[model samples]
Structures are given as C-alpha cells and as structure tokens.
Target: MRFVSFRSGADEARLGVLEESRIHVLHPGSTLLGLLGDDGERLHEAGAAALRDPYDVLDLDETRLLPAVPAPPTVRDFMTFERHVEGTAKLAGPDGRVPAEWYEFPTFYFTNPYAVIGPHDDVPVPPGCTLFDLELEVAAVIGREGRDVRAEDAAGHIAGFCLLNDWSARDLQLTEMQIRLGPAKGKDTSLSLGGVFVTADELAPHRSGTAYDLEMTATINGEVLGTDKWSSMHFSYEEMVAHASRGTVVRPGDVLGSGTSGGGCLAELWGREGFDAHAPLGPGDVVTIAVEGLDSMTSRIVAYSDRGR
Candidate 1:
C-alpha cells in the first residue's frame, strides 16, 4: 500500500494511505513506520485491513502532498553504487581509487531536512549556479530503531522506500572539496526530494537481485536527458543499513539515499567541462526524474534571472 504525508486546506501534515485515486486518512495515533515495525504477521494484517475502499475519503488531486517524512530525525545518503563512486572519484580524487574506507563501509552524508521539497514543487537554483544537476536514487526509511545491528537483520529495520533526487551544484562541490569538510555546500544547497512513498511489501519481490528491472529516466522540459537501470548498483540497501547502524541508533523516518546510477547525471557520464560546455541547464528549466515502479519527481529550476529583483 502507498503511504503519504499531506496537508489539505489549513490542516497540518498527517499520515494517509493512498487508495485508488483518493487518500484514506490513517488514524492520528497510527504512523507509517510504527505499523511496519510491528511483527510481520501483525503488520500484514493491519495493513490489509487498512486497504479497504477509499472512495469517499478525500480527493487525491485537491490536497497538497508534503515530503513523505518532513521532519526525519536523520537523513543518511549512501554512496553504494560502484559506478557512481568510481566516477565521482575520478572527478574529485586522484587515480580514481576511492578512499579505501569507502569500500570497507557504507559512505554517507547528511542533508538539510528543511530544504526538502515535495513532488511538483519549484526548485530554486541557488545564486551563481550555472551547473545544476540531478541524481536519481532510491531511499529507505528506517522503521525499527537499532544500534550496532547485524547485516543479516538490517532488512527488518526498513519501513519503506521512496524515490529521491539528490540535486547537486557542481561548482560549489568542487570549491568545498579543498577544505575536506564534506559535501556541505555542493550537496545541501540544491537537493530536492520526493514523489511518493511505497511500502516495503511492494518492493519485497524486487529485493532478490533477480530480474527486477527498475529503470530511471531524467527529463528536462519534456526532453529525456539520461537513463539508467537500478540493477547496476554494487551494494544493496541491507548492507547500507548495517553499516550505518554500526555504532549508532537509526530511528524512524531516517532516510538512506542510494547513490546515483551509471548515467544518473551528466556530470558523471561526461566531465565537468563537457557538462558545462554541452548540457548546461539554466533558469526556467523543468527536470523530472522517474523510476519504473516508484513515482516520478518533477522540479522547475528557478534560475537567477527568474528570481525577483
């Protein structure tokens, strides 16, 4: 079942289940993660019972949908994709030999929760940004809070998954790298996340690394810019969760981002100069990233020229 956090009229954001083309409000006491954290049998029964008809509950188009978990206590974005790591290494480091620690553990970064925007929202291009890029990724929401969890038991902590676009500012990223403080300015400023939240059950069948063909495509102003397959990742979500919870507790609403795919963005496919010289995206541009089973996230670039003086 699809779960969402939304606000209608003057009401505050709350949890709801998507049914047909409408939304059925989940009781105030019930939470998406809490339900999933319960025992498997109990959780399944509750979810099935909640999936009853939602015709007269609420209009899907009329309400405003917010980020699935607006106030996630912590957001961890992992670079588990080998292609992304090697490509980024070539761009940021020497010899393309990603730090040995990167391979030994799941590397991640924290993002600003306040900067998150929902589906169809406008993404403002930070001032002086000529090279804004989009990274298509899959994010998992932590359900059961745990510390030092074993890799084998990590899957149980996942509540659900959602599509994420970790927007990037290429120039700022380069500038910040010199300090070695982390990707604060390059990443935090331009990130736009959302689309829809799909329950873990819906993604269970695709977990086996079998023939699950999840495809991703990014389009700009109705033009297809890039495409990639999800199966290309070198690491799985369980491995990321295990690494992340090594010495700390992961709580409900925590988000884990699967790094970009092979052709996830132009920066990785082509060098920075090539991207700047060939595929420069400016103001008034709209970017839409879509994953096969997951939903599509669309954002309109608010260029410097477009902003009010």
Candidate 2:
C-alpha cells in the first residue's frame, strides 16, 4: 500500500493510506515517522490496519502533500550509479575513469533534512545560482535502529522507498567542491520527496541483486531529459546502508538516496556532449521525476520574494 503525509483544508498534518480515489486516514495523531520505529512493525501494522479498516477518509483533492518522511533524522545521499560517477569523473577523475579507491566503499554525502519539500511543491532558485539542475533518484527510508549492520542484513532496517529529487545549483556545486569541502550550500537548499510512500514489499518482486529493475525518468517543463534503469547503479541500497552503518547507527526516518543517474542532469549531458544542451532552469520551469512502481514527483522552480517561506 502507498502512504502520504498531507495537510487537509484545516492546515493540520495527517497520515493516510492512498486508496483509489480517497485517503484512508490512519489513527488520529499517528505519523509516518512514529510508525517507522521498531523495525517497521508499527508501520506495517498501521499501514495494513489503515487499509483494512480506515477510521476516517479524506478526498484526495482536498489535501496538500508533504514529504512522506517529512523531516528525516538525516539524509545520506549516495552516488550509487557508476555511469553517473563516470560522467562526473570526467572532471573529478585523473583520467575518464573513476579512482580505484571508489571501489572500496559506497560514497555518500550528507544533505540537509530540514530543507526537504513535498512532491509538487515550489522549489526556490537559490540566489545567484545559474546552473540550476535536478537529480533523478530514489531514496530508501530507514525504519529500524542498528549499528554495524551488514549488507545482507540491511533489508530488515529499510522501512520503505520514496522517489527523491536532489535539486542542484551546479555553479555553486562546481565552485564549492573545488576546495574539496562542499556540495553544502549548493545542495542544502531543497530536496523533493514523492507524495506516495511505497513499502519495501511492494517492490520486492523487482529486486535484482542489490539493485531494482525500476526505471527512472526525469523531465523539465514536460519534456524528457533522460531515463536510466535502477539496475545501472553500481552499489546497492543495502551496501550503502552497511557502509553508512560501519560504526555508527542507521536510525529510523533517516533517508539514503541513490544519487543522480547517468545523463540524469544537464550537467552530465554537457560533459558528455561538450556543449550546453539545455539552458539552466528559471522560475516557472516544472521538473518531474518518476521511478517505476513508485510515485512520480514534480517541482516548479520559483523566484521567491520572501526567503523565509
């Protein structure tokens, strides 16, 4: 079953499972975060029960979506796609190939959890950003708490999966990372999560090794940017989880992102083609990302008069 965290006409946050035309409300005051604890037993029970016997129902058109895991404890986005890494390596690598050390482990960077936005929300263009871009990816929401986890054991800790958009200020990212310190200011601005939260079991049939057979697609203003299969990723979500949990804890509500796919962004296209194929985004540009069997996410780029919003 798919779930969504939404705000009704009254402006209060509510959790519900998506039915055909309406949202079956969970128990009052229950949240996706709270339900994810205890190895997802709460989530499993809550989702199943809500679907089986809903206590309340809301019209789908009367709700505004919020990030499925509204405020993740931490967002660890991994560069799991080799082709994406290879494309980036054209600049970050000595040759055109990735460094040998890259094979040692799954590499990920911490992104801001507070900046996360719901799918279909407006995305503000960071001040002075010229090369605005969107990264098409999927994120696994960690449900259980565990330290020193093994790759094979990572599944039990995964609560569910959600489509994720890692918005990028390419100019800022390019300049900041030159000092070997950041992708911080460039990345901290916004992260878009799909409105629907798909449970792990839903996608289990498509599992292929550490990867899934899901296809990822991204478009800007209704035009296709590119598409790549999840199977193209070099590292699996489980491997990333194990690497992240080496000595620390993978807590409930933490998000792990499968970084940008090959040709996922215009930056890679420019790198591959040696020319600017698409101009940077501006206000009113609609960016959308879709992953097979999961919800499709959309964000409209906007120029804000008030940054506080």
Candidate 3:
C-alpha cells in the first residue's frame, strides 16, 4: 500500500493510505513511522481496514502534499552505488579507489529534513549553483528501532521505500570536499524527496542483489539527461542498514538513502562534457526523475530571488 502525508485547504498535515487512486485517511496521530513499527501482518490489516471510497477522504489535486515522513528521527544517505562511486572517483582523480573505509563501514551523511520538497513544488536554485545535478536514489524508512543489529537480519527493520532526488550543487561539493571536511556545504543545500511512499513488502523481490532491474531516468527541460538501472549499485540496502545500526540506536522514521546510481546524473555519466557553458538552468527549467514501478517526481527550478521569499 502507498502512504502519504498531506494537507488540504487550511487543514494541517495528516497521514493517509492510497487505495486505487483514492485516499483513506488514517487517525490524526497515525504516522508513517507508527505504521512501520507495526508488524507486517498488522500493517497489512491496518491498511486494509482503512480502505474506503477515495472521495471520502480528500481530493488529491487540492491537497498540499508534504514529505512522506516529514520529521524522520534521523537521515543517513549512503554511498553504496559502485558506478557512482567509481565514476565520481575518476572525476576527482584517475587513482581514486572505492575507499576501504566505505566498504568496512557504510559511508553516510546527515541531511536537512526541512529542505525536502514534495512533487511539483518549486525547487529553488541555490544562491550560486551553476552546476546543479540530480541523483536518483531510493530512500528506506526504518520501521524498528535497534542498536547493533546484524547485517543478515537487517531486512526485517525496513518499513517502506520512497523515491529520492539527492539534488547536488556540483561546484559547492567539489569545493567542500577539497577541505576534507566531508560533504558539508556541498550536500546540505537541498534534498528533494517524494513520489510514492511504498511499503517494504512491495520492494522485497529486489532486495537480495547488489543491484536490481529497476529503471531510472532523469529529464531536464523536457530533455532526457540520464537513464540507467538500479543494478548498478555496489552494495545493497541491507548492508547499509546493518552499518547504520551499529553502536547507536536507529529509531522508527529514520531515512536511509541509496546514493546516486551510475548514469544517475549528467555529471557522473558525461563528466565535463555535459555542461552547456552558455545555457545553465534558468528560472523555468523543469526536472523529472522517474523509476519504473516506483513513481515520478517533477520539480520546476526557479531562480532564488528575495521577493519570492
């Protein structure tokens, strides 16, 4: 079942489950994390029970959709895609290797949940980002809170999945990494996360392999920029979960991102060749990222102006 957080007219954000294009509103206190904490059977039952006529809840177009999990306890984005890692490394230098530390410990970063925008929202072009890039990723929401979980048993803790666009300011990222301070300013700028919020059971079939057959595509200004498959990742979500649960407690509502996939963005796919010196993204360019069986998110890149704020 698909879940969402949304607001309509003057109402506050509320949780709901999707039932054949209709929405069945959950209780006021019910949240994505709460449902995750429920066992698979219980979750299924709850979703089934909530099924009702779509119009009975609210009109989809009239509602203001928010991030599926608006306030996750913590957000960890992992660099588990091998193609992205290798290609990104090559861009930095010819000698870069998948860092040993990345394998031993899943490399991740804390992102701003407040920066997350819903589908169709205006994704403001940050102050001076001439090289804005898109990273197609899958975000996993934690269902069970745990500490030091074993890698083999990590699958049970996942609550659901959501499509994520790890929007990047390439120029900022390169500058930040140069200081060796990690992806502070480079990554902290903005993070677009939305599309369908599907449950773990829906994606169980593709859980085992380092990669899956899921197709990914990115379009800028109605032009296809990147296309690839999820099977390009070097590591699986289970390993990242296991690594995250080590030493610290992971709570329900925590989000884990599958780093950029190979060919996920122009920067990684075409390197310096993709950039158009004369025509950078202006105020009206639209970007759409879609993954088959998952969902598609479209955002309009608007210039940042003081009056708009």
Candidate 4:
C-alpha cells in the first residue's frame, strides 16, 4: 500500500492510502509516526480496511502532501554506495579511491530532521551557496525499536522505504569537510522526501535479499542527470541498521538514508566531468527523483529572500 501524509479540509494533517487519483483517509488524528508505532502492521491493516471500505475519499489534487514521516525521530544518512564514494574521492586529487576503513563498516552521519520538506515544496537556495546540488537516494523508515541489532535480524525492523533528495550546498560542504568536522550548515538547509510511503511488504516482490532491485533516477528541468539501480549499494540497509544500532537504540519512524547513488549528485558528476561543464541549481529549477515501486518527489528551487538575512 502507498501511504501519504497530507493536509486536507482545513489544513489538518492526516494519513491516507493513495490509489489512482484519490486518497482514503485512514484515521482522523492518525499521523505517519503514529501509524508506525509498532512495526507498521496496524497501518497496513488500516490502509487495507480503508481500501475495502472506501472511506473518507479525497481527490489527490485537493490535498497537500507532507513528508512520509514528517519530523522523524532521527535521520541517519549512510555512505553505502561505492560508486558515489569513489567518484567523490576522485575530486580531491589523483589516485583517490574508497578509503580502507570504509570497507570495515557502514559509515553514516546524522542530519537535521527539522529541515525535511515534502514533494513539490520550494527549497530556498541557502544564502551564500552558489554551488547548490541535489542528491538522489532512498531512505528506509525504521519500524521497530532495537539496540545492538544484528544484520540478520535487521530486515524486520524496517517499516517502509521512500525516495529522498538530500539537498546540498557543495561550496559550504566542501569547505567544512576540509576542516574535519562539519557537513553541518551545508546540509542543514533542506531535505526533500516522499510523495508516497511504500510499506516493506508491498515491495517484497522487488526485494533482492537485503537490497531491492529498483531503478533510481533523477532529472532536473526535464534533463536526466543520474540513473542507477538500488542494487548497486555495497552495503545493505540491514548492515546500516546493525551498525547504527551498535551502542544506541533505533526507534520507529527513524529514517536511514542510503546516501547518494552513483552519479546521484552534481559533485560526483563534476568529478567525473568538470565543474565548468555543469551548472548549479538556482531559482526555478525543478528536481525530480524517483525509485521504482515508490512515488516520485519533485522540488522547485527558489532563491533565498529573507531581507533581514
């Protein structure tokens, strides 16, 4: 089932199951987080019930979509794709390859959950960032709480998956990384997710062991920029979860991003080509990212206009 968090009939947020061009409201006060309270089975059942009962149906055009798990408990983004890592390293200098330690375990960074936006939202270009870029990735939403989870048992902890666009300020990020402890201001600005939340059970047919055999693609202003398969990730979501849960607890609604795929961002493309050959995102550029079996998310880029800033 495809779930969507949306505002309807007076801007009240609600959970709904999307079908065709209509959404069936599952509950009046239920939210995405509330729905994921316990491994998401109840939410799945509610969605199934709504589909059968055809209750409180609303047209998709009349509802404003929100992030699948608006205000997630925590957001951990992992660098699981070797192609992305290798491509990014090449930009630093010659003979750059995946770091040796990177092979030892899944590495991730915590990002600001407050900065999340939904599909079709306008992402303001952060002030002073001329090298804005979009990262195409997939994120797994945790369904159960666990500490020190094992890789073999991590699969059951995933509630669902959604398309994620990790908006970036390349200029700021590059500078921060050089100084050794940042990626902060550069990433804190905005992150876009969800046009739809697809439950793990719904995607079982596409599963390839620990990974999904789904196509991931990104386009800007109708031009294809990145395209890859979800199967390309070197580390699986299970590995990421196990690693993240090493000495901490992971709860439901916590999001784990698969990081950027190969050629998934301008920085990688620039490394593969040249900075002069590509342009940064500016006002009015539309970025669309899609994963097979999941709804696509489209965000429009706008210039920052806070006169006070």
Off by over 4 Å in 3: 52-55, 93-105, 206-208, 270-280, 306-309
Model 2 vs. true fold: TM: 0.95
Q: Give the alpha carbon lDDT tens digit for every residue of 1-309 in model 4.
A: 888989875867888899988998875787777766676778888888889885589999998998988888899999988889988887787577889999899899999999998886789898789999999989999988999999999988999988889999999999999889978989998988887888888888888855789888989998999888898888999999999999999999999999999878898887767788589999889888888777788888888783112
Report lDDT (Cα) of residue 48, candidate 4: 88
lDDT of candidate 3 over 135-180, digit per residue (tens): 8888888888778888788878877888888888778878888887
- Which candidate leads in TM-score? 4
**lDDT of candidate 2 over 242-307, digit per residue (tens):** 999998999999999989987688777766655356788888899888887787887888885543
The RMSD (Cα, Å) of candidate 2 is 1.8
- Per-model TM-score versus the true fold: 0.87, 0.95, 0.89, 0.96
- Taking every candidate in turn, the Cα RMSD to the unseen true structure, in Å, is 3.1, 1.8, 2.6, 1.9
Pairs of residues clashing in candidate 1: none
Superposition error at 265 for model 3 (Å)? 1.8
Q: Candidate 3 at residue 272, lDDT?
A: 34
Q: State in Å the error of residue 184, model 3.
A: 1.2
